[model samples]
Target chain A: MQLFFQHLINALQWGSFYALIALGYSMVYGILMLFNFAHGDIFMVGAYIGFGVATALAALAALSALALPNWVILVLTILIAMYLTSFVGMLVERIGYRPLREAPRASAAITGLMIGIILETGNLAILGAQRIRFPSLIKTQVYDIGGVVVTNKKIMIVVVSLVLMLALNEFIKRTRWGMAMRAMAFDYVVIPLMGVPLNTIASLTFALGSALAAAAGILFAVAYPVLDPYIGITYGWKAFVAAILGGRGSVKGACLAGFLLGFIEIFVGAYLSSSLRDLIAYSIILLILVFRPHGFFGEPHSAKLRL
Target chain B: MRKGLLLVVAILVVGLALSPCAWAKSKTIKVGINAPITGDIPKVGEGSKYAAEMWLEDIKAAGGLQVGGEKYMVEIIVEDNESKPESAAKAATKLITEDEVLAIVGPQASSQAIPAGEMANNYGTPMISPWSTNPDTTKDRPFVFRGCFLDPFQGPVVANFIKDEFGFKKAAVLYDIASDYPKGLAEVFKEAWENINGPGSVVAFESFTTKDADFSSQLTNIISSGAQFLFTPQYYNEVALIVQQAQELGFKGPIVGSDSWGSAETVKLCGEACYGLFFSTHYAAAGATGATKEFIERYEKKYGYTPDDVGALTWDALRLVQKAIEDTGKLTGNLKNDRVAVKDALAKIKEFDGITGKMTFTPEGDPIKCAVVVRISEKGEFEFYKSACP
Candidate 1:
């Protein structure tokens, strides 16, 4: 039972990253009907930006220039990094995607891959191949409840991810922009005819998704704390799997499927063998997709497919 | 009269250009350094380059290397392997066939060294890898040599060190399955541990692919498996995450590592998490005496940091090449014969004392040396703890 609880905590923390990044993929696909393949590199860029911000803020605190606490520095780092990385996301969409909006969908997908490569190589050129250690903002405190072990950072990561997800959920449900996005998801061509502003919705979707990915990136750095240029490749592909398994354009489904993916991976490694963890975990997901066809909350083929 | 003068001037210019090539064949000894200067492990390449440069400075100060009776000026041709096996092989081929170097020094990591060593052997050139510990590196290649003990030797060294130091009976092993070095070391360690404490002594054996950052599930299983210590033979990048995660998961026992944790970046990235942890490596930079201390001091003064095991071993490997060249009595001015002479001399080398250790070449071209257990002190220095030998 203790082992089970420990594995659960581990899964939740691991799942939070996928959930957050998958939300970006889901949102972009929701409005634009194109997968932003570069979303993973955007996550990498966000992490590097957060590293810069956190290091600067930490330096200020150390020098007594800013009378800020560690938690305050962390919050500022996340907020400032998200703000900056959103611009990067918008720039990528403008330069990489906007021109391809009228091209074939395959061309747009290819553009996303090219943008990803550029981002990764650009980071390598700027930072060199050395791995950077993310600053430890919060001192880790381990708590053992009975036989299960947990860390304060893990708790904070889970809480922050949940809060962001909830905030995104509310944004999609409450505002006029949210309604415009939903209408765009329903009928992108017709919604623009209703003065929905297609370009604005697309850019806004990218900005929101990038901001959330930045948050996820920072949280991930706090937990893992090792930053590398290629860190986004495998993670991006795995989260993409979550995005697809969640069904197209279903935010709730994407988030749930992300967690489900995490749980399956962790439990598989724990109960079976770590060597076969990915094999068995993905096999289970493949089985589920085979039955559901369109995933848990994915809609069946409808008139919306005409576009 | 004017045409004759022009012809004489042109002939003089041509002779001046061709004179150096004629002298270079016998009067100068050319050594090749195939290093990963641009790719994944650039630090290793940088260290090899710096060590070669420092060695060159000494040879320059002495005017030239004295071989048999005469002196020969030395030249080192450094090529970047880019940390890839194919690139390493390409670098070796370029060095041997194009540059016509008498000996080759690096391609340090086993992944690069194995392929590069094959290239050197096929060309019948003497190649010595400073840091490659995999047995396959020099297994059947007489022309290939290494400055470090093999992995098969290192495994038993670490196993005995752990048993005698802590009296631990059960262990857990975690390693990267995709990488050759870790996978090989992990198997050797597992077999050695089980041999000492009987079968089923390794309570948990876990593996992950490369670029994996999370090891919580594996740690949880290791913690619950009743193992005494955790042994992970991963590189520094993964070491920071693994050690920290294991600690956070309430695994109180000591975490052990192999020489892959010998990078300067390990302590820098791992910070206080790795302090006081133990790993078996070539040599400890802290508290050295004699030639090792002098080399470390000079290298630190020149490079602005402590030299890692890669730099120390590279220095030793280059010096071994130098000794082998000198032991050949004289360069025959024939590339093929001189290369064969260097190989034979390298194999016959006995009791060659290096900054890393005292080495004697085995018939397989591997060094018979002791492994040192290093403790990362609270001040973030690799302090010498104890020595383990076969």
Candidate 2:
């Protein structure tokens, strides 16, 4: 029972991570009809941004020779990092992906590879190769529930993910621009007919998705306080798989698929050899994609402006 | 005024061109140190550069690598590998083909040194790896060598350390299967451990990608396996998260690791819960021998930080190459022949006092160095425990 509970909590934390990033992927794919390969790199940017800000704050605190309040520094770092990295996301779209939006799919993929390399290269130049230690945002106080010492941050992660997701759903359903976005995704030719500016919608869409990625990045660093440039590549790929599995255009399906992926990965690694974890996870994605040409949540022939 | 500016530019350009000679005339012989100054393993790679730079300065102060009847000055050339395998290959190529260096040291991790090894082998340039411990790195490469012990030696040492320190009868192992160093070390430790503790001592031997973030499932299974010891011969980030999550899962047993655990950042990321964990490494700051003490004093005076295993191995590697160069007694002519001579001289090295210990290479061209044990403190520092090597 104890082992079962621990594994379940483990699944929940991992699932929360999937869900957080999957929302951005699904939303961006829904709006842009573009496979945003740079999304993961943007997430990495978010983590680094958070690390830089936090390190600075920590340094200042150290210089003062007095312990600063942990919560204040933590919240400030996450928010500042999210804002800065969101701008980076905005810049990525403008510099990397936007110019290639009208180009060939292969061109965009190549651009994505370049962006990934650039972000990683920039990290190499800036942070040096070693993983920088991040200060924990949440206290590591585990609350015992059914013999599982559930970490406070994990609970925060699940709660925060739900809150952000609900908020996103509300924004999409309640706002006028959300309706315009939905219409645009259905057909951009009719978008100008509906008096919706495509460029404005596109930027807004990237901004929203990037903001969410920033949040996930900060949360991820909280649970695992080691920041590196390449860390986001794996998560980005996994979350992308999750988005596609749930149906790339469908937010609800994305969340469901992400949770499903998390469950499968955790259970397999726990029950089977952890060495084979990646192989199993990727194989599952392949199987699903092979059968379901349209992702579990995404529609077939989903087309939108890529960049 | 235009002619005056042009003439001024000409004189300045000529002066700048001849300045290398001017600098060289100051009695400094350039000791080219090429490593991943930027990119994924920069901590380890930069440590290599730092150690080399510090050692070169000391050697220059103490009459640099004394070649046959002459004392040459030392200058360090640091390069960036950017963490890509091809980039590492390029760096080695540039350092050898273009730079025509006397000796080269680094491109730190095993994933990197493989390409660097071949590059050095082709050019007959003697290159030393500070911490790239995969035995295959130096397996067939005559000119490539290392100063620290390889993963095979480290594996048994860590296994024994855990078995004795934690009184662990059984252990669970997890590492990247793709990495030669991690897999080789895990295999050796598994055999040595099972031999002593009997069969079925390994409860859950799992594998994962080095790039993975969620290792909870593996840690949970290890905890459930009733294993007293946990071994993760993985990279620092994954190991930190594994340690953090392992403690969170309520398994407070001693976790053992390889030399990759030498970084202070790894321990800080793992936090307070990972205290008391032991790892096998090359150098511990405590119990310094006279030579090591001098090296430490010189390094601290130069770089302003205490030397870790990476730093120590780098110092030794550079010194080994310099020793080989001195034995060759040739400065410029027939450079290829000089390179081969250096390679031969490097192999002839036996029981030289290194920063870690007396280091020598086997016939396979792999360095034989003593492995030391260090335990993590509650304050997140590595405390020297004991040494374990033949």
Candidate 3:
């Protein structure tokens, strides 16, 4: 039972990273019918940017003897990284997707893939081949809660992720921009007819999703300080799967599915053989998808009424 | 037509004039350097290249290799394997056939070296793997050789270290199942550990694929098994993540590993979590002496960091090949026969004192050398702990 509780905490922290990134995938797919494949690489870029910001702050503090707390430096890093990465996400949408909006859907998908490659190779070119280590912002303090040790970093990851998710939820529920986004998701044809600038909403959706991914990237670096150019490739794909499993356009569904993924992987690795972790975890997900083809919260679709 | 005929005649004269001069002044010997210069572990490849370049400069300054009373200028042709097995084979083929190299060095990882070693054997060119310790790398291939000790020898060293030093009876293993080198080392350690501590001592044996980012699940099971020690035979990247996650899960037991864990990146990623962890390696950065110490200082001066085991072994490999070439006594100017001579000379190298230590090759082409045990200090540095000799 104690071992079970320990694993549960690990699962929650792992899920937070997936859940945050999956929200980006779910939101972009909800607004635009296209899956933002470059979102994962965007997460990687955000993490690298976070690394840069954190290093600069640390250096500045040393040179000037800035007595600011480590937590303050960490908050600053996350905010600056998210702000800068939002522009990167917006730029990717404008240069890569906007040019091919009127073209075939497959062209846009291919552009997403191309953009992902460019980001990965571009990071490699700029950073050179060495792996960069993220500076530890918070000293690790292990707290034993009834034999279930929880690190300060783990608690911070989960709490910050939930706070961000709730903030996004409140923003989408009450704001005019949120209303415009919901209307656009319902029907792109009627959104522009209602005098809502479709292009602005599209860029806004990408910006919001990219910002969430940046936050996830920063949190992930906190837990695992090693940063590499290719770190985003597999993680991006897995989180994309979480987004799909959560159902299209459902924020709650994405969060649930992300945690579900963490549970499945953690439980499988614990109870069963670690060698079969991926094989079994993915098999269960496949079974779930077979029963619910459209996903946990996705609505059943029929062929649209043709002209 | 007259101008064209004059141009052709001039080209022929120029080529003819340069050919004999090039041959008489100094014939050049090409050595191919195959390494993973652009992949996940580019640092390992970069280290090999730097060490080889240093060796090349030293040889060139001494006025080249003297073979049968003739001097031949040494030239190195390096190709990036891209950390792929097929790419390594292709690179080796290009080196042997196109570049016409007399010998080859590197392709550090076993996965890359094994395939390229076969190609080198087929071409009859002597190829020395700087860090590949898999027994199969040189099992039946006469032309294939390595600078590091094999897993069979090093595995026992680690097991004995745990049994004698720590006196631990319970051991758990978490290895990369997808990797041949790590898997093989893990199996070897399991056998040796069982032999020392008795059977059924390995409580939990778990595995993960290569490039796996998480290891909490594996740790949960290992921690539950009440393992006193953990043996993970994996690269620095995976080991760093494993140690970090293991610490997070509150598993406080000592972690023991193979030589692959001895890297500069290990401490950087694992941080304070890596302190007190131990591993067996080819050489120790701390308390190094003689040629090894000098090489480390020179490498640190040139590369801005201390050389790891990979760099040290690569340096030794180039010197080993040079000694063999000098031992051959003659080149005969024939590629095929000259390659055979080089291989024969390498086979005759019984005992040689390298920077890594005194290396003696067994008949199977694996080097028998002293393996050092190192510990990660609280300052996140690889400190020399002890040495195990065979």
- Number of the top-ranking candidate, with TM-score as the measure: 3
Candidate 2 reference-contact recovery: 0.83
TM-score of chain B of each: 0.91, 0.87, 0.92
| DockQ values of all predictions | 0.57, 0.55, 0.60
Q: Write the per-residue lDDT of candidate 2 for residues A1-307, one digit (tens) a residue.
A: 8887788888887887788788777776777667778788788888778878887888887798647777788878877876777777777778877787788878877787788788877876776667777777557876777667787778878787778778878877789888777777777667767689877777777777787888888888888887788877889888888988888778788788888889888987877657777778778778988999676656666664211
Candidate 1 lDDT score at position A45: 95
lDDT of candidate 2 over B116-194, digit per residue (tens): 8888888888888777888878888888888778777787787777777667787898787776667878888888888
Model 2's CAPRI class is: medium
lDDT of 1 by residue, A138-232 (tens): 99999989989999999999999999999988998998888888888888878799888999988899999999989989999999999988778
TM match of model 2 to true structure: 0.88
True contacts kept of each: 0.82, 0.83, 0.72
> What DockQ score does model 3 reach against the true complex?
0.60
Query: Which candidate should be chosen as best, given lDDT against the real structure?
Result: 1
After superposition, candidate 2 runs with Cα above 4 Å error: A1-5, A52-84, A94-116, A301-307, B1-34, B62-65, B70-75, B83-86, B330-332, B366-369
Candidate order, DockQ descending: 3, 1, 2
RMSD of 1: 5.6
Kindly report which residue stretches of model 1 are placed more than 4 angstroms away from their true locations once superposed. Answer: A300-307, B1-30, B38-40, B63-87, B90-101, B329-338
